[model samples]
Target chain A: MFDFFIHVASIACLYGVLALSLNLQAGFTGLVNFGLIALFGCGTYGAALASGMGWHPLLGLPAGIAMAALLGLFYARLGRKLSSDYWGIATLSIAEIIRISITNEQALTGGAQGISGLPLLFAGLKPYDGMARLALYVVVLALVWLFCQRLVKSAFGLSMKLMREEPQLARSLGYDLDRIRRVVMLVSSAIAAFAGFLYAHYLTFVGPDQLVSPETFLIWSMVIIGGVANNRGVIAGAFLMQFAMAYVPFIKDALELPTDFVAAARLIIVGGGLLAFLLWRPKGLFPEKVGGSNGR
Target chain B: MIEAKDIRAGYGDGADILTGISLSADRREIVTILGPNGCGKSTLLKTIAGYVRPRAGSITFGGTDVTAVPIHEKVRHHKVGYVPQTDNVFGTLTVAENILLGARQLAKTEKEKRFAALMDQYPALAGKKTRKASALSGGERQILSLARALIAGPEILLLDEPSAGLSPLMMHEVFDAIGAIRDSEGMCILMVEQNAFEALGIADRAYVLSLGQVAMTAKASDLLEDPAMRKLYLGGEVHAE
Candidate 1:
């Protein structure tokens, strides 16, 4: 039970990072990034490639983030001419292209079989392996949470919200839209890639299947359910989602439901929950807080 | 001081809305641009504000050609302030934040100093400094917008239809605030308005635009007495204030 609980907590922390990252773009900056999975895949493949070459996971982390950043910049440049609606389609297509590339590139990515047995995060701390690993994840989560809080409260955060709410006004106020969009893409993608690096190391595996659209949808749901712009709400949303994702299968088993019905039921529940929330609480659990002069 | 000489401009691939229009405003003076609907009054102001680049001619402010300067660059480098006819205030932001948004480049001490002075000038806004700008009345929103533009210490202020969508009484109050700004700041003020009589009442000079062309340009007082001006633009009757 202790090991299982730790495992669940670790996974929750990992998803929490992803939720926070997506929230920074979709919630705070009002950017619709449908290609989060591509960035996540970049990080996973980066870590996998590095570890497969016998490099430490710590050394592999930056490699993953850099790859995600480069991809994000490319997307930003491409998205310049497209409207928001088209941008969404463009990002989704990009994610699909990245997944297809990974699937076909057998020589470089080990093909569909994937690379496995990557180095553990705390292989040095052998006796208390699970606890130490969980501790590391928790520490990273805390640092990210604190950093997000500080960011959203600062002048930079104000500029981001302004850009989201009033792009023309933000531009008139001297905020270069191109530069702001690029920076946001870079920052959020790097953060998501960081989470992916940890996930790949923890699972000791990397495969194209892990970069599916459903995984990205799960993160978006967490952000939407928690509250778009509120980081604390995002964390709470992640836990709620982690709980549902974990126990829905258990409930299905207890009911003796057919294996095919499991995926269908989970989708129905999540979709229905999102619809209900949109109708009743469009802003999510915590609405974006607009600060007054007191903040200055 | 600012000058626009024969600027011809329009939206992309659209016919020229501001066709060979020229105007100027000097320090501590108010220049009013008046026209009928679709006569390009707002477009002329937009051209001057850097929203529309002129296809010909040039705009000079502070003795340097600023025709090619972008809106944000004009604001940051040339201290050019602009308030759109509508959506002037940031609805989600508080009144104080709206005013302080332009003061981002100022030192903390200077920002506080300007905030105090602006509050003193517009007492009504000072009372609702902590409230969201959307909660303010239409007249109050106009005042808040003015305070915001003024707080930036702009050398040139461009206003588009400052009295649009306001009651006569509120309009009077808004014009009073504009007069106060001119008296206090001594900045070059250029305004585009449909409120002909009231605008001419405060303007030092007035230009009447007809079909994107300047039909009349003279001292405001001189145009107010001109019978043709009253007949063509001012509705042939001045409402009793």
Candidate 2:
């Protein structure tokens, strides 16, 4: 049971990082970035490719971040020509194109066979055996959390909120909307890629299948159902949804229910939870506060 | 000094709103553009503020041709300040932060000094400095808009319907603030307003616009007393003395 709890907690932390990164663009900037999975996939692939080349795992982390940021810049350039539903469609198409490219690039990415035996982030430490490894993972998660918190409170963050609420107003006030948008996209993509690197290193393996459309949909649902604008709500939603998905089988086993039926039940619960969240608390657990005097 | 010569402009390729319009403003003068709705009053202000590019003609500020300048460059070079009619204040920013954003291009020490000076000049903003702009009353927001504009020490202040959608008391306060600025700061105040009588009453010179063209230009007091102007532009019934 203790091991189960640890596994669940670790997975939740991972998803929480992804959710926070998504919230930076979608929630704060009002960008409909359906291609977020592309950045995550890039991170996973970049890290895997770099580590597979026998480079230090730490080197792969920055490589993944840089590659994802470049992709984000590409997305931002594309986003400028579209907005709202049109932007959503454009991004979805871009994501599909990226996934197809990855799948087809057989030689470079090991094709659909995927990459395996990637080095662990802290190879010197034993897996799940010592407090050091657990502590390191926790520290990584904490650093990501701190970075996100700082970003949301910064001047750039406030500017992003302004752009989201009213682009015209933001422009009239002298903010260069296009430039800010690009910067935000790059930063969010880098963070997502960083999370991806962590994921690849932790698992020591990755594939095109891991970067599928379903993974993208799952992250989006986590962000939207959790409340796009609320960071805490996003983290809560990530953990709650991931844990529920992972733990339902245990419940089914205890009850002696069929495994297939239990899996279907989990999907239904998740779908129902998403529907309920949208209908009831559309703003999530912590709605953004409105109206206050300017900062000092 | 600021001047617009033969300035012809409109939205997109639409008909020119300010056709062959010519206007000038010097320091220490209050020039009000009085017109009915959709008469290009705001367009003229926007054109001068560099928000709109005139299709033909030139805008010279301080004897420099600034017709092709971007809005921010014009703001920096010509020291032009604009207070838009709507969403002038950032809803999420505190009033103080909104003001600071106005002075963002300034040095940190200079921005702090300007902030202090403006707060002192407009005492009403002192207590509400830390309040978010979205939470302010309409009048307070207008005051914040003015405060933000003035913090930059702009040579020319372009105000677009500063009193629009405000209560009578708020309108009076805005005009009073404008009057005080004119009396004390020697800032060039060029404004577009729908309130003809009230605008002309306080303005040094006023131009009446109709169909995006200038119909009349004269001393504010003269325009107010012109019976034909009163009948055609102002309401048919004049305010009793």
Q: Which has the greatest DockQ? A: 1
Q: What tens-digit string does per-residue lDDT give for candidate 2 at A72-159?
A: 8988887766766788778788888888877788877887788988876556765544344456656766787777767777777777
Alpha-carbon RMSD of each model: 2.8, 3.8
The best candidate in terms of lDDT: 1
Clashing pairs in 1: none
Candidate 1 ranges with C-alpha deviation above 4 Å: A52-54, A78-83, A110-114, A123-128, A293-296, B12-16, B53-57, B210-216, B237-241
Candidate 1's residue-wise lDDT over A1-296, tens digit each?
Answer: 67777888889998999888888888888788888889988888889999888887677789999999999998789766777778878988999988888888888898888888888778787768889988988888888888877777778778878778877676666666677789888888888899899999899899999988878888888888888898988888888878776677778889998887778877866687677778999888977776643321
lDDT of 2 by residue, B67-91 (tens): 8775666666678788888877887
RMSD of 1: 2.8
Q: How many backbone clashes does candidate 2 have?
A: 9
The candidate 2 chain B region of ten consecutive residues with least summed lDDT is B232-241
Tell me the DockQ of each model, to 2 decimals.
0.50, 0.27
